[model samples]
Target: MGNTPSRKGYEKQPEKTTLFKKEPTGITYRIPALLYLKDTQTYLAFAEKRSSPSDSDAKILVMRRGSLQNGSIQWSPSQEVTSAFLPEHRTMNPCPVFEKNTKTLFLFFICILSNTPEHRQIITGRNKARLCYVTSSDDGQTWSQAKDLTESVIGKNVRRWATFAVGPGHGIQLESGRLIIPAYAYYVPFKCFSFPIPFTVQPHALSIHSDDFGQTWRMGKMLQRKSCECEMAEIIDHEGRSHLYCNARNTHGHRVEALSESSGAYFDKPRLAPKLVESRHGCQGSVIGFPAPEFVPNDEADSIGGTTSPLSPDTQTWLLFSHPTNKTSRRDMGVYLNRSPLHSSGWDQPWVIHSGPSGYSDLAHSEDVEHFACLMECGKESELEQIAFVSFNLSDVMQTVDKREKKEL
Candidate 1:
């Protein structure tokens, strides 16, 4: 698989549906996080509606509902989920995690004081950010007032962070009822080489989790240094023990991945996942795990033995990953599958989604329809101009089918 050329070999091409377009609605729209509510059987698409493409200009968080009706996604008009009209402050990073037991949704994000830009924060080593969230019982039809959680959940840790952000994508809830919001914080280092820069800084992925169904949240130990912009997945291994899998953005050529044995309270040292390389500075990617497909025999191995071989440890479940296939440009969004959750080499060659301009994406599965959906940033001219949603069946990915199925609102 390593020898497979990047962006050269792809078979399947699914239909692309535009969910949110920039302008007349908002001057600019980006950073999408898609959530599928099982109870409501609805798709919630969240994005930052900004005055411009500037990071600090997104004053409002917008959402839209898409009902799963008769095998098609029928989208509703977009509405403002939350906004901060106060000067120099804006909401960013829309990350939502559903609590199955309570049928509640928690939307987590960061409020940044624009007076201090990210570059200044990186240099000064002080984060002018607050963690906040809103809840909904009616599957995004209505939402509770936004609540600030920085003081209680992060507390003094903010003092050490230069800048921090929660998932620009979706978070996950484990089978054990542990809810986690994947996040990253930039920390300024004490040592500096006074030459090209006055100080050094690094980012690492961490988790803020809730055990009591969003009543309270707690910080988890940070993953190894230099990881950022992560997404989390709950994976049950062959041993029957549940593990938290983290796939994070990295600037060091490849994606950073780690596993947590303690339901995301802590993670082992992170390692580079070579199969999932990052584009340029890095791009946020999406990951999801589904039930493993029935095992098929390898003809070469079967010829050697008459006895049937048991499935490998990696076959306990399957993981689906989405990201840009190119190492340099955020184009050609691809979906990768891996039967082994722990081994980096197990990822199959990607099945390309958008062969043109594409950026950050979030993945969700529909149990009723037995298909997966990808909400991503894509454009005809530039990658960040519009947010689109695409759906595909598991067979399309596994078989690499070259087909497109269109469904319009």
Candidate 2:
């Protein structure tokens, strides 16, 4: 742990507003997916409205619209996406990606059988989930009917998977106009030669991508490593080359990372980021890339293990990640910085934004305001009490890091 930020100053809190609160009727909101529209200066927050806190209890998808005003977000009331569902099935995992050229918002999700749990599918070696999406041309005011892409996109590959799910967060659109939706599947290996075919399920991360805008789609090759519930970002290295960076959930005590040079068509072997520890049993995290700042203080760079060389803005891409910081439990929602996005190291100790019980989160960067927004599950007693929204800038992250550095010295 060379100069890693200390775990002090947990009491310093950022201003947050609860966008989706839990109800006394056992209705809970989980799996937040956030997206920011640069053109309209607006934010779209999505989540699963579950009958209870369990995955099998997920009921439907809901969203809220937030407008930037006076440096704060004014969020509208939550609305149920009735059109983004199939009859008699439960909707879950709201993964939204915006196609800038057509100004269309595609909210991708999986519909599982009403009472079918993921574990059951894995054990039985059968898939009962359908890949679907609903598009919104005018932001999220109204959505088109859900379209089932299971047969068209996945097609024959569905037989290899016991189960699969898209991002519980947001997706990305690359500079070349390719839309990438981070996803994972529990693959059933070859069956054993027995009366009852024995199955071994292994999870791997992959992407559902469309190069010709949203007109056509296909699945990318799966990662060789065991990863799941992932998010992707496009990073331009210092040498002016673009790469797709994937950070995924794993049970190996550390997060898994892989890079794709072919715009997500395939990925290289993944390496675990030792600095980024995973919560017990694993939890979903979010990653996004933005242009590096024009100047960075030497002390700050050294403290976070970053490069100090001078580089023009937009020449290199820096990353920000959000997840639960605690290794043994899901708590302390933290935001981490990686000045060197192309490398496995240089991930600084996180700036803990929410210090109490917290769970799945999504991060979005607003270029116009140079602010990052996070929609997360946090509460005093439980992480599932409500879905809250918070925003901070680079200065705020550095200030926290700077304070911790002085305390350590």
Query: Top lDDT: which candidate number?
Result: 2
Candidate 1's C-alpha runs over 4 A off are 1-10, 24-26, 83-88, 191-199, 295-315, 401-409
Compared with the true structure, what per-residue lDDT tens digits does model 2 show for residues 1-409? 0122225565366777899989999999999999999888899999999988889999999999999899667889889999999998999999999999999999999999877999888877789999999999999999999999999988988888888999979999998999999999998877554211454588899999998889889999999999999999999876778899999999989999999999899999899999899976999999999888876545657678855655454337889999999999998889999877777887877898887789999999988445798999988799999999888888678667766767888
Question: What TM-score number comes out for model 1?
Answer: 0.89
Best by TM-score: 2
**Can you give the lDDT of residue 291 in candidate 1?**
70
lDDT of 1 by residue, 213-266 (tens): 989999998986689899988888777788889999998888899999998889
TM-score of 2: 0.93
The whole-model lDDT of each prediction reads: 0.81, 0.88
Alpha-carbon deviation at 360 in model 2, angstroms: 0.0
Query: In model 2, where is the ten-residue run with the lowest total lDDT?
Result: 1-10
